[model samples]
Target: MTSNDLGDFLRAHRARLRPGDVGLASYGRRRVAGLRREEVAVLAGMNTDYYARLEQGREHSPSPQILDAISGALRMDREARDHLYRLAETLPDGHRTQPRETVSPMLSQLLDGYTNTPAFVLNPALDLLAANGLADALFSPFGKAENLARMTFLDPAGRSFYAQWHRAAEAVVSSLRQATGCEPHYPRLHQLVSVLTESSEEFAMLWSSHTVYGKTHAAKELIHPEVGTLSLTYQSFDVRGAPGQQVVIYHAEPGSPSSQALSLLGSLNATRRRESTPER
Candidate 1:
């Protein structure tokens, strides 16, 4: 929420690493926790005083060159790099308000109409903006819980639901890292990433990897408890004018058993909904 959210982010990364992680050799008498400030300064190729100044909010607007060095030292992912740059942009007093992003209504309706397929919309931070009924059902548990990244990394049963949980988890965290670059002033996103980076190693590892990716059509394999295995084609379309928004659609192959299963699942949901309604 604060302009310093990104600072908390940087410090969170530091706390996760050990002195030995960045080639720092420590004696047995070491009393402080985590890598010392000097060690990070060395790793970042900056003078200790400057690094300390940056961390304590005494300095602002570091050059791109310095940002890159600090990114490398922190092992920041694509999202983190962008976040570092944004955090670097500041007044001596520190007030930065990023524009609020919104999904187009037409795009939302398009997603709803893609009922045969499971389609959803997302912003840069991977926040679920809109989703069709089927997409809602397939990812309902996650959508209902609120945050996709949290569901993938922090949910115990959620991990078990995805057969390839590790790969999917990495992708989610890494994608979020890319988002940080695009919207460093997003308060909700900043909070979510802050909480995850602190608690999840899976998230931290991926965040530090510096990998980036945009949405693309992909075939995903999923194992639903009730339905067993499903193979589906997932495609993405960018919102007409929304720069960082995307509408992602998932379709089962035509005439494939997966398609049939999705139909059955939809029917089941409809029946459940009908039953829950009053007789009138």
Candidate 2:
């Protein structure tokens, strides 16, 4: 990574925020956009010269305490904070030291038990390592699904499948940014980023922002070909024993129309399973 990368990232996020975002009053016509370097330094409780040097890549070693203060001052979320620490080569709190690429059999079985919910396991690169039948059905729109990042950016159906297409696409790229910070040497991730950046202009733009995010729990809307429109809440868990692997499960509110639609899809899936099983 270039020395300017960290500075660029900080500048980009800083440029996106306004004075009012961090509770600073907007007084006069600003000569430059967003919060100025001095404003950030004041908010972070550090010297303006020091903060400016950091942004200019001249200040190399910032203490963890300083990083923490800056993160809060910048109003960075957990994921973004982690990214900041990682970019600076400081060990982030709760960052997995070991990144596993494969899912364990026990976890795979655990996923299968969630019959009513769509559950799948993904690696740092967003490769669909293991998925339950419901997840398979849920993602069937991307025929022969391989990687979530690829499916989201490459396939035309992705725009239709993701009801919040722009948000979803942005989040996907941000997640990839987080993954890149986690494991910079992963060849597959490098290839995926290259392909998406080359193919999709939207992806290229978001990727350039250097925003890092990880999927945790969020509301998602999907327009499924078979089940129609369904709103679901997804929760992501880091597989403790597996390090880099994350298990994501999707569910709808009980007794909701989306829930009923999911049930119908499950029933159809069950019938298809039975039909495919030879007489025994």
Number of the top candidate by lDDT? Answer: 2
Local distance difference test values of all predictions, in order:
0.73, 0.87
Model 1 CA RMSD to the hidden true structure, in angstroms: 16.8
Give the runs in model 2 whose Cα sits over 4 Å from its true position: 1-98
Taking all chains together, the TM-score of candidate 1 against the true structure is 0.61
Provide the lowest-lDDT 10-residue window in model 1: 90-99
- Candidate 1 residue runs with Cα over 4 Å from true position: 1-104, 141-145
TM-score of each: 0.61, 0.65
Model 2 score (lDDT): 0.87
Per-residue lDDT over 92-130 for candidate 2, one digit per residue giving the tens place of the 0 to 100 score: 544334467777889989999999999999988889999
Q: What is the C-alpha lDDT profile of model 1 across 1-280, one tens digit per residue? A: 6756666767777777787777778767656567677888999888999888777777776777777787788887766676677677732112233423676778778777776778887776677877777766677555354567877888775776677888777678767777776666667778887888899887888888878775545567777665667788787776755656777778898889999888877777677778999996
> What does each candidate score in C-alpha RMSD?
16.8, 15.2
